[model samples]
Target: MRYRLSIEDMEPNHWVVWVLDLPACFSSAQTPVDAVALAPGRISAYYSWLSSHDSSLPVITESIEVEIVETFHSFASTQDQEYLVNAFFEDDRRPPNYWDVELALRLLQWTRQDLLKVVQSATQEQLSRPMVCEVRGSIAGIIKHIAGAENWYFDQLDLALDRAQLPDDPLDMLKAVRTNTRAQLVKLMGNERITKNCDELWSARKVIRRTLWHERDHTQHIAHLLAHL
Candidate 1:
């Protein structure tokens, strides 16, 4: 029942909080305490709405894992980067030289949750609204592009997942693709034979960098679109 939460400083006197485990559950407040205070109500409303639409929705418990990334002050410090680097290298149980893959998985989880916050909040009307600038596609179309690209990246690892027709709900489609990508990543990272067989283009280093970049790029795009909405 526990869920993860990610909080980031958005601007002076404003903080954005996201329930990482729950799609579309985000709130902003002028203070970090207020931001944290808003989470329960937002979560309750999300579950209430979900239950009204589908009786099978599970109940959420009070437990939470919170990760606060405050970027307004400064970028990640050396200590923070070192912590991530150490965590990536110290887990020796994983296949040798798979640190990049593991790091990518961690980052993907963060970016996907950020992306979901926007997708969940968008109305059908908003999703269909035409883009005004040079950036191609409507909000929903861009989301589909993000999911589609992840699927394509998995294919580069020689792990072919059966492509299903995209669902009308952007969140649903994203969840499906994210699940498949994570599975493929785990399989590839754990298997030395598979890793060795992969082409240089799909090397863990390249794959991790490209995947993170793609996710972050589109996440920013979604944020921009939401700002316009």
Candidate 2:
């Protein structure tokens, strides 16, 4: 099967590769060639893992398109990255039943990881630096906002997870919130009554759409902010 691989240089000899169609699935290698070569196996492994969890296999494409970009500045933003790395499966093409929920979860996971990649190398000063954007806030503030918003949606569904708390380290806070929110979502998926709630505010479809939109929206915000740093 064919897939699209977006390769980015991380350091002098390090590279990271993202399998575009498969959310949260990526691999790293010392060289671009090696990273490209490793992608198919990583993709296969991801499918294996997914099969174990949900008993479904993803459609594999026949060829892969490898697009490489230069190393980002240590604190640079991803605003200018040409590849559409976060593309999710469209609703029209989604499988019926809970499979779409699974896909949404995967997309959310990928969005969180993409956000982390943008800020992972930032120093404290960079993270705290002010940014001029529609969402006016520091990098850390934005991260907190993203995490907090997710928690709020969970709350709307009456999920009992705790609200997101900002920690001394912004990335740590992100990790905690993502873990907690994902756990709650897994629980939500298993509860049909909750998943199929008729109310507009807590319907499973609305929750999934909103969560994905919020995550993707702020992810772009962070990327644009970092680009100006």
Please give, for residues 1-229, the per-residue lDDT of candidate 2 as tens digits: 5666666564457666766555546666888788778877777766665655456655444554444432322222245343222222222122224665578777676676667778776778988877666364788888877777776666756763565344546567667767766776666554434332221214444455556657765776778877877
**Candidate 2: regions farther than 4 A off:** 1-96, 132-136, 164-168, 190-200
Question: What are the per-residue Cα lDDT tens digits for candidate 1 across 77-187?
Answer: 354442211111111123424665665566577677767777778888888788777365688778878777776666656664566665656667778888877777766
Candidate 2 versus truth, CA RMSD in Å, comes to 12.3
Q: Note the Cα lDDT for every prediction shown.
A: 0.59, 0.60
| Best candidate (score: lDDT) | 2
Q: Tell me the lDDT of model 2 at 136.
A: 43
Name the regions of candidate 1 deviating beyond 4 angstroms.
Answer: 1-99, 132-135, 164-168, 190-200
